[model samples]
Target: MYQGYLKYKTVIAELDSAIQLRINIVLFLASVYLVLQTSVGFKNPTYGGAPKRLPEKINCSASNRGFI
Candidate 1:
């Protein structure tokens, strides 16, 4: 009975360690993804630009009006 209990404890300890390692890995991946997303967003202007297409004349007018 004592030996069985010891085996069970060892298994539980291993499972706990594995779970902690997995959680750490997931958090690291999430942090990496967030950093990559932020870098991409800042480097790519289209990510924050208008979604609709504007006419060239309107763009020129806006530029002339100092709204650009």
Candidate 2:
């Protein structure tokens, strides 16, 4: 408010505090989402499946090929 700003510096300080609170809220939500995803992401079937393989474990021979 123009009246508040002209009278004292408290108005600007209050606005700055409100802005910081909003920013802190956003950051907290983002951090919570990141932690949740990181924890749940490991439980996904794609991650737990046997797709994680080494080149040596694969059988690339003709007999092992399917409809190739």
Candidate 3:
């Protein structure tokens, strides 16, 4: 009975350690994915995978003259 108990404890400990290692790996991968996703989003506002230029600034001074 003592030997069986020791074997069972070791098995449980090994399984627990394996599970923890897998969880850590998954969390690390998820963090890396999130970082990459955010970086890609920052590169393109339109989500079209191509970097686009910002809209040209309006010439408010010139347009206001027309209204005046």
lDDT of each: 0.78, 0.74, 0.81
Clash pairs, candidate 2, are: none
Worst 10-residue lDDT window for candidate 3 reads 42-51
Which clashing pairs does model 3 show?
none
Q: What tens digits encode model 3's per-residue C-alpha lDDT throughout 1-68? A: 99999999999999999999999999999988777766676555544334567799877896667976
Error of 3 at 55 (Å): 7.5
TM-scores, each model vs. reference:
0.60, 0.55, 0.61
Q: Which of the numbered candidates is closest to the native, going by highest TM-score?
A: 3
Which candidate leads the pack in lDDT?
3
Ten contiguous residues minimizing lDDT sum, candidate 1: 43-52
Instruction: After the best TM-score superposition of candidate 1, give how far the Cα of residue 35 lies from its true spot, in angstroms.
Output: 0.6
Query: Which of candidates 1 and 2 reaches a greater TM-score?
Result: 1
